[model samples]
Target chain A: MKGADRSKLAARLAHDVGKYVARAARNMPPRGATPAMVAMLATDLYSLAGGRRASAVLAELAGPFGEGDERLATARSLLEEADRLEDRLRAAEPAAVERGRAIALEVQSLVLDFARMVASR
Target chain B: MRRLLVIEDGSEYSDFARLYLADEFEVTTARSASEALRMLAAESADAFLFDLRFDRAEPGTLVGDVDATARRLFGGDRGRALRYLQDQQGALILAELRSAGHAQPAVFVHDFPERRLANLRQLYGSVAAVASFDARAIGALLSR
Candidate 1:
């Protein structure tokens, strides 16, 4: 894709990811989310990690913008962590939900950072 | 550049403004109503930008009395009242700003329903809103 198109897509992804992270944070943790709630969050995180959309787009953009981009690298690693969190959630681990929430917050910050990078470009 | 004051519970809106609106606006940010008021008292701004949902804001920093709202609207359910306050904190902050005699135009990046949007305009003069973080659209609203 062209640079302009890539930037647009990055912005859109950042917006979507930020919104998802906020919603997931609200539904998790000290609010006393149920096991089913954690499962649902895990399912969505699975999609965000390697499913057809977000990961593919991130990989494509990484080719052009990822070089020497610490934020992009961090975002990629965090997504990998998200994937692991999903697995732990599937196993119904005790601390997995809280861990997922922490990952979601990190993802939210990185999404904003990604948007900032795209806007600067 | 016009000075734009952004108020939100988190840094997203302010970060966007700095990254995308920097050429058109000199951005200032506040994380709560009291902070915004203090900033306004120190300097003037050409416009204001608000984030509608403040789910991450500290409870004490949030506007509106949770107890009062619970009694009046939520059958004394403080949890529900607290959620309502977080959901509507942006508007509450704007109300405080208005009461403080700041009449600058205020903009929000939210797609409020028609009636709700109308109500906001009715309550707060010089209010504007767009549905998303399109920089050009936001700049236009702020410039207006």
Candidate 2:
């Protein structure tokens, strides 16, 4: 992809992921909707962390921004936490749901922080 | 220093301006189109820095009419129309500014295609865009 296209994709992904994570943190779904919500969130997290588009965009961004290793490490950490939360939520444990919410909030913060860093570059 | 008004639904652009462009420009911010117009009516800015997507903005503060947009373009799907408005809010805001007789140079941090950028310049005079939030690039665009 061209440089402009790459930057556009990276910024769009960052904004989208930040919004999704923030929403998840703000509104925990009701009991009946929890499964669907968790599934959707998990899909987003997985895509953000490991999907081809995301990886490519992040790699391109990492080079120009010179935060390649740190950005990749952060994505890996988020992916692991997302996996653990998905497993725990499968059991329908109340504590697991709370933990998931907390994680979402943390992820949201991190995403915003990353965005700010990118913006200030 | 030249005065630059950063307009967006959030603090990102203004924060970037303050942190990165303070030495070259005096920065002011408005989070909605109405607020920006009001500011412009009271005082002039040498340039504008716009954020294209206003996803975090409240529905009411957005520049376009959602219902009308849905009816005209989205087959009456309000959800899609709202998203469209949010995504294009910056340009809509520019349209408003132009209509209101504010012809200051406007810059966006977006990778707009050549044709689209040309269209914007045609529709709204003195429009420019950069691909990302590089302070140097944005500074150069705004300075011009």
Across B26-55, the per-residue lDDT of candidate 2 in tens digits comes to 999999989999998898999999988998
List clashing residue pairs in candidate 1. Answer: none
Superposed Cα deviation of residue A27, candidate 2 (Å): 36
Segments in model 2 whose C-alpha atoms lie over 4 Å from true places = A1-11, A14-121
DockQ of all candidates, in order? 0.04, 0.04
Which digits, one per residue and each the tens of the lDDT, describe model 1 over residues A22-115? 3444334544666655655564466543343334445565556545667667767776776666667677676777776666666667766676
Candidate 1 residue A83 Cα shift, in angstroms, is 9.3
Which whole-number lDDT from 0 to 100 does residue A77 have in model 1?
Answer: 76
lDDT of each: 0.73, 0.69
Please give the clash total of every predicted structure, in order: 0, 0
lDDT of 1 at A109: 70
Q: What is the TM-score of each candidate against the true structure?
A: 0.58, 0.59
